[model samples]
Target: MEIKEKITLDMLTKDSVSVLRQKFITLNGEDVQVGGNVRNDFTNCEDDRKILKEQLSEDYYNAVMAVWEV
Candidate 1:
């Protein structure tokens, strides 16, 4: 599917994790390419990941992780 509409952080909602994941991918993709923990050296962006997981809801963070699989 093609996402033509502009995706903004306003679209993020705790109402649905799956939906949030899709939106997250559309916006942030995966910040997992940098700053990841040494234990999880396979991918970077661990600090960012942790921040999101802490500041934002777990659902959105999980969504970010789902895309990190790529």
Candidate 2:
């Protein structure tokens, strides 16, 4: 799914320690399976960052165009 939104770190870290521990398990690929909550959160964060960056670049271009037009 495409994420066209922004999310704060606090929103992602609501579970704090539990989320970190779960992420560690999945990162280590330890036979201990971590649920989709952590995975989806990471995915959404990454996708949202990409979308935000694109939006920022477009805004920058528009601002530069306005300056050049002036």
Candidate 3:
């Protein structure tokens, strides 16, 4: 499924962790095999930061940062 809108790290404060996690997966096209896995858990701020910093592509990162800056 396609995401209706852009997502960002700021979503952590504005939306539920579950919602943000789903958006992250959608935006990044990640295959979530396990529901409760660490890679998909946005509740863990450290993990979220790591994914943003190390895993996500440049396009996705820039898109997220654009939303964050606004």
Q: Return the TM-score for each candidate structure.
A: 0.35, 0.20, 0.33
Best by lDDT: 3
Model 3, span 1-70: residue lDDT tens: 6433333333433222322323223435664332432323343345565666575568765555454443
Measured by TM-score, how close is model 3 to the native structure? 0.33
Q: Give all candidates' CA lDDT scores.
A: 0.38, 0.33, 0.43
The count of backbone overlaps in candidate 1 is 7
lDDT ranking, best first: 3, 1, 2
Q: Please list the residue runs of candidate 1 whose C-alpha ends up more than 4 Å from where it truly belongs after superposition.
A: 1-44
**Candidate 1 clashing pairs, residues 3+ apart or interchain:** 34-44, 34-45, 35-45, 35-46, 36-44, 36-45, 36-46
Q: For candidate 2, lDDT tens digit of each residue in 1-70?
A: 2222222232232122111223223234434433433322222344544543464456532433343332
Best by TM-score: 1
Better of 1 and 2 by TM-score: 1
Q: Residues 1-70, candidate 1, lDDT per residue (tens digit)?
A: 2343221233333331222122211335632222222221112256655655665466645665666644
Q: Name the Cα RMSD for model 1.
A: 14.2
